[model samples]
Target chain A: MTRRLSLFNLTSLIFGFAFLYLPILLLVVYSFNASRLVTVWGGFSTQWYGALFRNEALMEAAWVTLRIALLSATLATVLGTLAALALTRYGRFFGRTLFTGMVYAPMVMPEVITGLSLLLFFVAIGLDRGFWTIALAHTTLTMCFVTVVVQSRLMTFDRSLEEAAMDLGAPPLRTFFAVTLPLIAPSIVAGFLLAFTLSLDDLVIASFNTGPGATTLPIKIYSQVRLGLSPEVNAASAILIGIVTLGVVVATLLTKRSAARARRDGH
Target chain B: MAERSLTRKLTASLVPALPYLWLGVFFLVPFLIVLKISLSDPAVAQPPYKPVFDWSDIAGFFSQLDLDNFETLVGDDLYLSATLSSIRIATISTILLLLVGFPVAYAMARAPERHRPLLVALVILPFWTSFLIRIYAWIAILKPEGLLNQGLMALGAISEPLTILNTEWAVYIGIVYAYLPFMVLPLYAALEKMDDTLLEAALDLGSPPWRSFWTITVPLAMPGIIAGSLLCFIPAVGEFVIPDLLGGSETLMIGRQLWSEFFSNRDWPLASAVAILLLIILVVPIVIYRDVEARRLETES
Candidate 1:
């Protein structure tokens, strides 16, 4: 029975990973195709990569997307960390339920609703729907994800170390910065990365909030895709996949090293 | 001493106050604006909708607010059918995600302890990739002259290419592909945390393996099942990119309807009403998720 079950489990993993990965691998492979016809492979070539670089619009959009992601992610991490701190530490504040609702609602709210509503709100307030508007919208949308990530880490945190600091005459604020912050830094970093990726990945919300000058990479890719498939677009997609993979890998390695160092310090 | 302490107190209060104010303005206010826009009449003017409220006459503003857009939603079959189809697609896709996601999550949970983290990371890697890129990858595979057809033809499985692209079937594949991670992650969390000894003990007793799994594993994984379902179902219902990129013109999901109404038709009021109704359908699930999260957090803390 155990043998059969192991076989069953292995089969499930094989099929699932294939389904998950094969499409993406195919996309990356097609990016290297030399033919103008995207479905046909003439030979392996770097022409699309060169074409992608010369596509001024795509490059500009990528720059704008990176800026927006960076700004919004920083803003979200700060606010979300505060919110997480409030949820975990500030027991029974006024309007806690409403605050919690505000935090949680955005995570599951349909992007269209969020997008439309944010657009309406901006118009009503007479805010110009430009780069700043996209940044603010992304910050609001992504903060909840950060809060969830950081809050989980905050829950698992050892409070005795914090208590020990306070017992040794450290002020509450000082102790938090000196002890709590360092311990939870890994989660905050994780939250920031998640928020950054979400900002970069957004289309619908950015679509609604965007104006003439604020075209994001996702918005750009989407319009090109609607026109039809191309190797250049495939190359662009492959590059994005590469960047995200590299970022996640680097982050994992950094976190692992820090954790090991902390473990050694404890011993 | 008093002045110093007062300054410290104010600084202490700043932590929660800042986030609270940010969410109130950017999150809560936008939703209120959506509600207001949903009630107003459509217009050809700038900002698209006439102001229903006048600062001078608040009571008159209340009277001016009418259900014209909502009435149009009820009167027009387009809005009704779009909403129904959206729900239908979301419901079906959610079930498909569960079917595909559960076995994979179970396998990951039952894997060797050292390999579990790597498995979870593998599942999440694709999620980090651009959502547009993932959907675009399928267009290459599903188009009439796409790879799927070529492969099938080469194998002599069919003489002609299957017309899968720009159809509801393509939309299903896109949705199931895009949201698979959302379904699997929570289920993995639940299943991994489960006590395997219980299953072992059940098998050691009179119960068979399958029966023990049905009784012990399935019941314990119920919470994850609900979480994964809500996570996938809610967003899948309002999915715009998948349906637009993959589905035929006849797809008629509410997200696309909302997009067209707002963008193509420039009927902001009607679009707002569509958004409002979508919110209503989603509210129950959103609240349930919040409840689950709150309980989970409470127990953890």
Candidate 2:
């Protein structure tokens, strides 16, 4: 019975993985096609990659996206870490429920609502809907994710260490920076990465918040694809996939090494 | 010296309150702005909406608040149909995600311990890729002359290409592909941590494998199931990009309507009203999720 179960499990994994990967594989393959038509492969060629390089609009969008992602991710990590610390450490406080609602609402809220609401808020506040607006909007959206990720890390943490630090005459702030921060650094990094990717990939929220000068990669791609199929989009997507795959691999290696070092430190 | 100690305690709490204040200003403030906009009259002017409130005439301001947008929302069949279709799409997508995600998550959970991390990584790697690009990939596959049709033709499975792109089916495919990772990860977390002994004992008692799965595994994974369902459903319901990109005009999801209302027609007040209505619809589930999570954490400690 167990043997049959293992076989069943293996078959499920294969089919699931195939479904997950086949579309991506086809996209990557078509990016190399010589023809302007994505379907007909006129033998493998790098012409789309060359075309992608010369696409000034796409490059500019990519640059803007990177800046927005970096700025928002840093802000999100700091705020998220604080929120996580508050919820986990401060216990039941006044308005904790409201604060918790604020954190989780953005996670499940439709991007359209968030984007529209933020746009109106910026307009109401007399703030220009430009690069700064996008950053602020992304930070607000991604911080909730950070709080959730880091809060889980904070929960699993050894409270005894913080107590030890305090008992040894460290200030509460000092304990957080000196001990608690280091222990939760992995989660913070994870949160930051998640936020960065989210900000970079955002279309709807950024669309609502962004103005004339702040086109993002996803927004640019959306408009381009709306007009017609573009091989350049496939090329851009391939590059994005390659970068993310590499980052995931590197992150895994880093996580493995850190976990090993942690195990040694525990011993 | 005593006052100095009081100052330190004040600082301790203030540090944590910074994020709370930031969210209060940016996130909560925005929702309030949406509420305010929804109460105003749509206009043709730049930054179009009218009847700005004056503190001096607070009572007059309250009286000037318009329910026109919300009333029009109720009167218009477009808004009603868009909302219904969005919910329908989201519900069906959630069910499909559960069906596909559960097996993959179950398999990963039961994988050899040494390979579990790698298996989880495989599941998550696609999620890390740009969501837009993943959806873009589907356009290539599902379009009329796309790979899917070519393959079907090669197999002699169809006499001609099936028109999937610009259809609701395409939107479903896009949502399922993009959000699959969100559904699987939580389920995996739940399934992996579950005690295997219960299943082993059930089998030892001669219970059929399928029966043990339903009676033992499904009930225990309920929390993860709910979490995954909410995560996928809420976002999918309001999804603009997928339905706009992959679906036809027939796919009148609220998100796309909200976009056209705001951007194309530039009907800011009406769009704000639609968003406020959508939020009102979604809040019950969000609150329930929050309570479930809060109770779970309380019990964990």
TM-score of each: 0.98, 0.97
lDDT of 1 by residue, A3-121 (tens): 23498889999999999999999999999999988888789998999999999999999999999999999999999999999988888989998988898999899999999998999
RMSD of 2: 1.8
DockQ for model 2 equals 0.67
> Clashing residue pairs in candidate 1, if any?
none
List candidate 1 segments past 4 Å from native: A1-5
lDDT for each residue of candidate 2 in B151-263, tens digit (9 for 90 to 100): 99999999799999999899989998899998999898788779989999999999999999999999989988998898888888889989988997778999898899988
What TM-score does structure 1 among the candidates reach? 0.98
Q: After superposition, how far is residue A138 of candidate 2 from its true place, in Å?
A: 0.7
DockQ of each: 0.67, 0.67
Per-residue CA lDDT of model 2 for A6-72, tens digit only, reads 8878898999999999999989988999998888888888998999999999999999999999999
Segments of candidate 2 deviating more than 4 angstroms: A1-5, B2-7, B299-301
